[model samples]
Target: MAQVHLRDVVKNYGPLEVVHSINLDIADNEFVVLVGPSGCGKSTTLRMIAGLEEISGGEIFIGDNVVNDLPPRERNISMVFQNYALYPHMTVRENLGFSLKIAKRPQAEIDKAVDEAAEILSLTPLLDRKPGALSGGQRQRVAMGRAIVRHPDVFLFDEPLSNLDAKLRTQMRVEIKKLHQKVRSTIVYVTHDQVEAMTLADRIVIMRDGHIEQIGTPLDVFENPVNTFVATFIGSPPMNLLNGVVRDGAVVLEDGTTVPVPPGYQAREGQAVQLGMRADNVMPVGHSLPPTEHMAQIEMDVNLTEPLGTETLLFAELAGAEVQAKMLNPRPVEAGERMTFQVMLDKCHLFDAESGAALRG
Candidate 1:
């Protein structure tokens, strides 16, 4: 395993600069994921690290070697892309052993490596099947097995699970995590899915436009987002945002609703801000709400309810904005009914209205 480092990395397509100068240090054996919306330069960055795309500026280091001018074959890195990229005419065993065969490795060693990869991926049953007959998930495993055969210093994945169904994607996410533990190799994965990023990464790098927004463990970025963009982008259902102003040590929402400011906050009396609260933190009464340091109770009309088996997602009107709240151990909730909800004030986030930067105390 080797550490991957990027210093002031930049990318450009002729006159248009896509990726701004970015700096990241991925520790040895670390499973780092680069995630963002489409065209955010995540795949481009991954390609640069794999030596598939040329860098416009700065340097990339794999362990103690400077691999700026190295070709893909010389970089000792294997990349699995979104498409399976397996040969239709080749059997799973052949596909896994092709790279070694191309390097003129002895047939016995190639067979040994192929068998080992098949065992690790549980693909021994499908080894004789051609890519055409295999399922999507199985074909993807063969793609990963090919990479495993190389025993590369770094493994790169470019949204490798995007082509699968939701259920299969979840299963593969767990398989990929186990693969990391079994191989103990450095991996750089790229994806636009926050669910995948949250579940599989040791640390996640959130990108927007062409710049890195924030980099931290999934929980760190989720709990303490630096800006409104990150706050809304990193979570499911996203964080609810209510535009308002701070007055009288409380936040006044657009519809004249007032919610207590989070404790220990320092802001001007009349400063404009956006108040944010996660769905789980703000729920209807009688949901076993925890003992929060600061909380606010408000009456709001329920707009809709989405029952998701274990819990229901309640949508309601708050300060004239549609806010989503979670209801665990839920009872039947009808639309148009009035309900009293509690907002966990201590977990709330405040951001400047003008710049959208988090207002830290």
Candidate 2:
């Protein structure tokens, strides 16, 4: 295992610079996931760390070795790609041991290494089968096993679960997490799925437009986002944001509904701000949750309700915009009906309307 560090790393293509100067430190044996939307330079950053993309500026260090000019192979890192890049003609055993064979290891050494990798990934039964005969998830395991035989200092996963079906993807996620716990290698995984980042990473690096938006543990980022973008991005169903103005130490929405502003929030009366709340923090009175700081009640017209087994997602109009909230142990309700819900103002977030930044006291 190794610690990876990037200092002012940058990527440029002619006159256009896609990745701005970014710095990050990845500790030894830590699983850090880079997550972002499409075209956010997340994958580019991962490739740069693997030495697959040339840095336009700054230095990259993998275990105290400056690797800015090093090739991917020289970095002693193994990469698992999204497409399961396996050799169709080679059996799983041969595929896993190919790197060792190319490095001139003896047959016994290759066999031992291949066996170990297969055992780690539960691919022992499929060792004799070729990639053409394996399922997508099995083939992906073969790809990871190939990387394992090399005993790399770091592992880079470029959306390795993207090719599998939803069920297989969930299953593979557990397997990957188990593999990490067992091997304990430093890993950098890149994916667009926030759920993947939440469930897999020790810490998540959220990137946007070539810049890092936030880096925090899943719960940390979800509970206290730095801005509207982050507040809306890290959680499922996103956060509900309502435009309002500060008045008499509280926020007044467009429709004259008021929710208390948390004490010590730096805001002046008549300031334009946005009130943010997560779905879990808001609930109908009957489906009660304890209040945080202050709880304010409001009635809105229900537009939709989606029953998600354990909870039902309710969509209603608030401050002229549709906001979503969750109802746990929910009872059925008809659309277009009026209903009352409580907003937990203490758990709320406030953002400067013009800058979109969280208002700090």
Candidate 3:
């Protein structure tokens, strides 16, 4: 029953506003992530929810109560930070039970909570070991175990995996996902990594420049980005964009390469636009996916090739801009090799050149 609601929330430092008035509704037990580039007010917003930062304007509600004035400790929430923040001298068990110990909980209660958390995080064998004795991933597990021992109604994670190595980050991502499934607590996580947002969040709140850009499920935002920023930001390698103009039922690229406009888009004649396509949607004919109803064929010379195990990522120039295309079924094409590629028109996008907004029908 720990649903969180932010009503026109705003955070200001002196005269400069860092977080603009924003509203959000987080249902109980939902795992929501606040994600964007550095200084986008994501962490600030999470801190406000955690009662770490005082809101300059508007109200915050946790469950049925207004918690705008409550301190973080009094809000029944636990936060796992980027730094492990474990007591160096304390054993894993001691660290896990420290918060409860400070609260003067009964010894039996402390033992039970600590044991449960250790069991959940598979830290039972490390209970006697200090933080210095644990590996990076193990230390992170201990951190999570400490948070779990509190049995808080909500969990706030502020870039908890940023300090870990790439491999450990991936491992911890799985652990965190499993933790969410087991705990079933309302979680508000903040990170600048879109991959983390895509993998961990039940819904992602994409922010930019102190304002929320979009809020939706990961796939919802990926396949249907509302603007150029999101189209380029949410996915790896980003969607390719090329300057173009709509002319006679086709989009004419900068170098006079004409491609049929994508399906289901309302493009004005003679309007400046940017044609968008993802590497997955553009592929060499023999190495392409099943042919779709609406497709455009184009020829380009491969400038570079990244041979991923299953598919190769072919880099080529289109309309004077570099565009990435995927090559399936394996290929050993040298640089400067000419190849005909099929563009999945239904999967492509068009954005207003001036505003970068999607052109939907």
* Candidate lDDT (C-alpha), each: 0.92, 0.90, 0.93
Candidate 2 vs candidate 3: the lDDT winner is 3
lDDT leaderboard ranking: 3, 1, 2
RMSD of each: 1.2, 1.3, 1.2
C-alpha RMSD in Å of predicted model 3 compared with the true structure: 1.2
Candidate 1 lDDT, 92-113, residue by residue in tens: 9999999999999999999999
Top model number, lDDT: 3
TM-score of each: 0.97, 0.97, 0.97
lDDT of 3 by residue, 1-361 (tens): 7999999999999999999999999999999999999999999999999899999999999999899999988999998888988999999999999999999999999999999999999999999999999998898999899888998989999999999999999999999999999999999999999999999999999999999888899999998888898899899879999999999989999999999989878799999999999999999999998998999999998999999989999999887899999999976999999999999999999999999999998
**Alpha-carbon RMSD, candidate 1:** 1.2
Give model 1's clash tally: 0
Residue pairs with backbone overlap in model 1 = none
Give candidate 1's whole-model lDDT: 0.92
In candidate 2, stretches whose alpha carbon ends up further than 4 angstroms from where it belongs are none
Q: What is the lDDT of candidate 2?
A: 0.90
